[model samples]
Target: MEKNDKFPTRKDMTYWIIILILFMVGSFTVYYGSNKDMVSHIGFGGTIVSILLAVIAIIYSFYQSSTYESTTYKLDTSAQKIEEATKQLSDVSEIKTVLESFKGEVKEINESIIDLKGISNNIGNGVNSMKESFENTKTTFFESFNPISPKHVEVDEIDFSTNYFIKMLDNGGNFPLFTLALANQAHINKISKVNLRQYNKIYMKFLMGGKQADLGKDIHEAFRNIQFGMLSAYKSSRFVDIDFVEDDFIQINDINENLSQAIVHKVESLNDEQDGDKPLYDFLLTMKNKLSWDEE
Candidate 1:
């Protein structure tokens, strides 16, 4: 049934048939002779040569059959190896494709990291700029009002210590002048126990549009006089009534309200060409919270 099988089988049959014919011819020549002695003498050499030839032919057929089988086996093995190698190459190609995809994803991740770093740097720069701006505004606010000399007072001066109120006075607008006068009157009464009722009187006077010609100078004098009086009282410990001073006009809400109004007015007066007012506003709020008005 196999293609190669047919060829080898046919060759083997041909070799066997030739050997059988030689053996039959040699046997017949010996058996059917006219004289037994003559047949033996004539056929002996020929029979021996034919028998040897038949043996050589049979051996050659077996050797050729073995060679064909070995060649066929080697061809089959080589074909199987080629098939396995092809399969391995295909698998390697698939692995290469997967590796390429992985590389692309890694590239994208690296780009994202770069973008995030850029964003972080921008945020840091913005925060630094804001901090610098705040510091500058703070310096300006404090420098605007210089402190009064210690030697310039009639009565002992109360170093309210914080210069914010004085600075507000220096900013100079009608509201600041009125607020300073109010604070001064309160400070004088606290220390002197003068019972002047100046706060009630002045509040009414201002409400009724008191004279404005010399009002500014009057408020400044009153502020200085009150500072000296409070300082004198503090040194003697004669008017050390913390409750009395704290309960008067220097309450937290009252100071905050005055400062808020002053700041609003200042910001509103600025021209369109002016810078932002947020820093100044924040400075005022910080100052308001820090106002202790206590002796320290």
Candidate 2:
């Protein structure tokens, strides 16, 4: 038979029955027995049995109290868990409501996107038409607007221009010196570099050349002369500018002239320093004299 978990088991009931029967036997012995000592012993045994019963009752009451406390704790824990679950469900419901509102806003955005896609398709078609028109005009646009494209200079034009420029530099109003005075220094430098390096080389080759001939120092001399002239012109141009600006050229010139004179005198004083060894001085002073012009 399965053991019942009910408060009193069969074994406990049997123990209680045995104890009560002993108590009854002792009571009867005390009441009716003729021997005085036997009666007194039975009386004392009954008292002890009664005390065991009282102790058992007290133990049972304590067990019941502990069981009640345990059940109450379990109930309290279940109630707290249930309250937390209810709070979580309320939060989930609030989140669902927010999501429902967001769904309507997303639907509106999707509708706007669909309309925008249609408008964009029309814009794309218009752009395609404009792209074709631009493609047709592309070559002319670059030819007009592009600054990097090389100019179309004829061979004869180059020849005539070179001769005329040299003649003007030699005889006519000194065009380059006048240009240096009028134009910005940076602009003048740019023009000089292009002409001296590229056009001058071409002009020299055209004027005198076997296919493989070297026009050695002719181009070099021209380049140096251009440099010196530019410097001299720039110096003179500064004077003209200061004069126009009502600044005394001589006052400004005096400081620069003194500085220049000091540098020259320093170099000259080195002559005295190197009096014993002229070659060392001479080596340092290579190309010290002004270079003669081609006409000279």
Candidate 3:
């Protein structure tokens, strides 16, 4: 009812009918006038040949249609495969992009770790330096308060008379007549007990108070002259009496005690005043402590 679009139109059908009628009439006339005689000569063989050619033309048309259909199907399948391969390539590219991003992140994290390690090393070094400084400060602080111990020497090896005699001569003191008498060993041996007692009394007094600065210069010089004479006499006599010289004078304990008492008196006199001799006083106290002298 919709005019059946696949069929030929009325005008085309009418045209084709007229052309068919004309072809049939023309063909009949040509066959009757010319081919009728020829057909009588050739008989049915010519008619059979025409029918075989028509059958071959129909078979060739069918083969061409089938080949066209197969080629179209193959082309469609190839296009589908190409589309799928393109999609897979796109997915691989995306994966590569993700991996590159991840690698960059990992590199950043490694760099941060290295930076942290450097900071940690710096902090460790600072702490160690602080500890060393503290230890040095502590050592210096303790040493400031602690006193150093002194070295002791043997007293018996020292020649007290000779040492005193040299100090006296160096001070420009004069020798006495008793020293000249004692220079002769025979006169020294012949010295009487009464004379020895008087000599001992004078020498003991000189040793006890001779070195005092409070004594007048004349008295000090007189005491030094007498000390020089007495020391020269003792040395020339060659007396090895430890009590007379070495133990009484040159022993560190006896000398430290005597010097300590003198320093104490000097320090007391400088109380509430400028202490010019404070260093000397401290030195004597240290020496006395080292000698283990009893404090007076």
Best by lDDT: 1
RMSD of 1: 19.8
**TM-score of every model?**
0.31, 0.32, 0.28
lDDT of 1 by residue, 93-155 (tens): 998999999899899989989987876575455435434533443343333332453322223
lDDT of each: 0.47, 0.44, 0.43
Say which prediction, candidate 1 or candidate 3, comes out ahead on lDDT. Answer: 1
Per-candidate clashes come to 2, 0, 0
**lDDT score of model 1?**
0.47
Displacement of the residue 19 alpha carbon in candidate 1, Å: 25
Tell me how candidate 2 scores on lDDT.
0.44
Winning model by TM-score: 2
- Model 2 poorest 10 in a row by lDDT: 242-251
Model 2, C-alpha of 105: deviation from truth (Å) = 3.1
Clash pairs of candidate 2?
none
Considering summed lDDT, which 10 consecutive residues are worst modelled in model 3? 247-256
The TM-score obtained by model 3 is 0.28
